[model samples]
Target: MKRQQLALFIGLSLSALSATTLSTTALASQASDPQTVFSQAYQSYLAAVKADENVQQTAKLAYTSGKAVYGKSDDNTANLAINYAKAIKGYGDELNEQRFALYNEAHTILAANHGKQSIETIDALLGQANYTTSAYKAANFLEQVIDIAKTQNKPKFVADMKLEAASLLAKKFSSKKYREAKNYLEEADEYYQENLPENSLERIKADFLMASFAEGRKKYNQAIERLNRIVNVFDSNLNFDHSAELSAHSKLIGLYEKQGKSEEATKHCLAIAKMVPWKESQEQTPLYRVNPDYPLNKAKQGRSGSVAMEFEVDTAGFVKNVSILNSDGGVSFEKSAIKAVEQWRYAPKFEKGQPVSATSQVRLDFKINR
Candidate 1:
């Protein structure tokens, strides 16, 4: 097992002891047949998921499986479904120990029997990938799917697999398996190049994923390059929507701003607001704001000390209220600190890249000794 897998396994086994409580709350107040009720709930969940593109399809699928089991009226199957959902929802008190472990074992057996080349095996593996909290399992199973997609020479399937794998990578970027993720993404990129033509949606998607990985690594300039390519490609095609172009523009502006390239940043910011009506809030306007900074204050002299200050900025950029969120036996010195911060300079807050008056929270640390 890899380092990430080891971390995931250890994370799964802990010293926490607790009892399982099944939620019959929805069932207890039942006013209809269990099968009908479950079917309706399952359908509602699917619609709720489909209506929102951001909804994780995996959650909905799990619900559908539960509904099927419940509709059969088998006590054990119904119990398994409820427990699986509880584990998924992080409902610690409602977890079913036997069912949860059994679900895992069932998935493993299914995958082992069908082999990775079978679509049935892929579906079972993907289901397990979706329901678990283990990042390692998610990444591992997704990799397996990608492997099958590649060997199968299915363009659309390959694209879908890569995108899903990239998304998981973005979530687990901080883990030790990032290198493996990069390798998979590179493989995906090659597939896109061979299978997806210029200006194809899949190519654009591939570009976006590579750019996101660059951003995660703090390679701002590289990220900018990938995003620029995406924009240029779409622009030349004249078939893509302005919204996609605007997204790339926003990303570039943010990258430039983070790089402290004020001139480049301003240029992109203006372009974004003009190109997209919703981005006007990013413009610079006069707003009372304070940039908080702190220095190590381990050693100092005198009766002065440092403390945390919380203040609210008004819509007009004025410091309206100041209070200590935390104090180290030194509330007396806070008044002076707040007074000084009130006069601080700030660029105006913008909503959607357009200049807009807004309330922003700021934190200040006064180090009396430093």
Candidate 2:
């Protein structure tokens, strides 16, 4: 058999039929000989396909069997139709002509039986979006899903769908579409801000997209800010190996390079390189420095102080083992100093031609800029 047909057969064969609630008479008949009753319809579907019968006829039989076992408005029937359509399209032959019609028919049936705003219908729409050939059409389907979500008062779902649409729009090669993509991203951001926490995965995803938009528009500073926010969020809430943090780091390096800030780019590269063993025949140095923000309260009180911190720069160029050696400032200044220093990325130190951990001390002065 063809590859697509073989795949479809494997998928269908592995799927277990689910029992549906039925009328009393039907239930009694099903209980009497459940397997035989269901198999009769299913086997007929299989026989029709094996005999190279009409594609529609075979799909109809599959749907009939699925409904018999899983109810008219069940996901099973929709899946059967979708699978059949995908298989037909994969054939890339005369049968492919009817694939889209079959898909639309399936979605129409689902929406008719299960209300258009129902979760079942929304799921079917999402499935259709994935299966459709045109990006614009897929985005339209997602927009419809979002509209339904709004009617259902699901802000999170609306945000998720908006992000999906934005992501799709961002993939287009035309720069003209970037504006539209940005609009969608902004809408997604609004919803996310209202519904998700600062460190939530969904919000991070929005930040990533917004950063991309900024980069596309040549707003390097804005892009850098967004990328840094993503990194900070991931570093604070997720493991080191989280994909978003890695992506943010990579993007930051690229953006810094574009801005001709080779030193900044190199710092991030060294940080990532710490993941592997490397040899450097030079002493470590500060590549980037961040000044601590003087607390407003301290400034109003006319307070000026200094904080000294000792930390270790690991092979990956990340600061760790931060200790407060001394602090003339109050707790507010000390906290700000630690937060800024922790975000610092350093150049790797070399000992005997190999990168190794090194300890260092630094003092930060916090004073109100009168």
Candidate 3:
């Protein structure tokens, strides 16, 4: 077997079928069973992922032939539907409707075959939750999975479900859903703290969600504490930059700023500015951005305007020498834009691997209901 194909077979628990010598192209011609053809095409689809090749046709073949062989309620058909849905998602955003249809089909088949609360059904629902754009639908699916998981001896699965539920529920941001999200976060955090490594990604994700929930509820101190712990874990355990670390620092910064702790916020702003790549190496690029608040008077008039500003980023990444190039609104818009830009930080340009001050321009738009 090809090395990548063998790895995929192990992952899919299809080692027995992996021994077959038929290529996907030859499978239909050589084997009378649609099952054999579907299985080979499925393997081909997996191989395509590793090869960074598109095999949507093969994926479709897997689905159609698998359904013919195993029927709709068969576990094999359900699995094929779910995996192909995920694969189709990778093709692009254009297939979103089709992918959702596949997930819905898989969930229905799995529920019929294995009962509503079975692992297969739960997994299919989770897939739908992951792909759905609507927060309400995602939360509904995750809530179902979490409820079902509670009835089984599946602490880890239940915890995972709760964590997902917490993330989506918080997005709803209503009082009831917010409290529900908080409860779910607490449960997920407890399980992760007890069962996973302190520095594990799963634990960190739970902590991050907790931090977000805290921030949303105006509990700044609590949010800061949670984010700081995450920062410490990333620093001491990982000793490297990750997107999660950036996110923690970003949250810490806004929380500190909201609490009137400019010094602390600046510290994180600078820290974040240094973590990512700078502009083209020839231009300064923003790392810490502050959105301009709508001018109260203009907002009252239901007005909207934009101001373009040219600014100098100092060697330390602080904005300076800011000048409003032009504005479509009035002086209020220009002043607000400049105020926000003054607090912004950037990745200063580097020449010969040394930091250099550089000029950058940005247009800040102030609008209500935008």
Q: Highest lDDT among the candidates is held by which one?
A: 3
Whole-model Cα lDDT of every candidate shown, in order:
0.53, 0.66, 0.71
- Which has the higher lDDT value, candidate number 1 or candidate number 3? 3
Writing each residue's lDDT as its tens digit, candidate 3 over 225-289 gives 98998888977866544777888888887787677776677666656666665656454546556
Rank order by TM-score, top first? 3, 1, 2
**Candidate with the greatest TM-score versus the true structure:** 3
Better of 1 and 2 by lDDT: 2
What is the TM-score of each predicted model, taking all chains together?
Answer: 0.54, 0.53, 0.77
lDDT per residue as tens, model 1, 151-225? 877776776676666655655443756776677677767877887776766667667778888998899888999
- How well does candidate 2 match the true structure in TM-score terms? 0.53
- The weakest ten consecutive residues by lDDT in model 2 span 10-19
Candidate 1 local Cα displacement, residue 267, angstroms: 2.3
The TM-score of predicted model 1 comes to: 0.54
Scored against the true structure, residue 187 in model 2 reaches a CA lDDT of 92
Measured with C-alpha atoms, the lDDT of residue 281 in candidate 2 is: 40
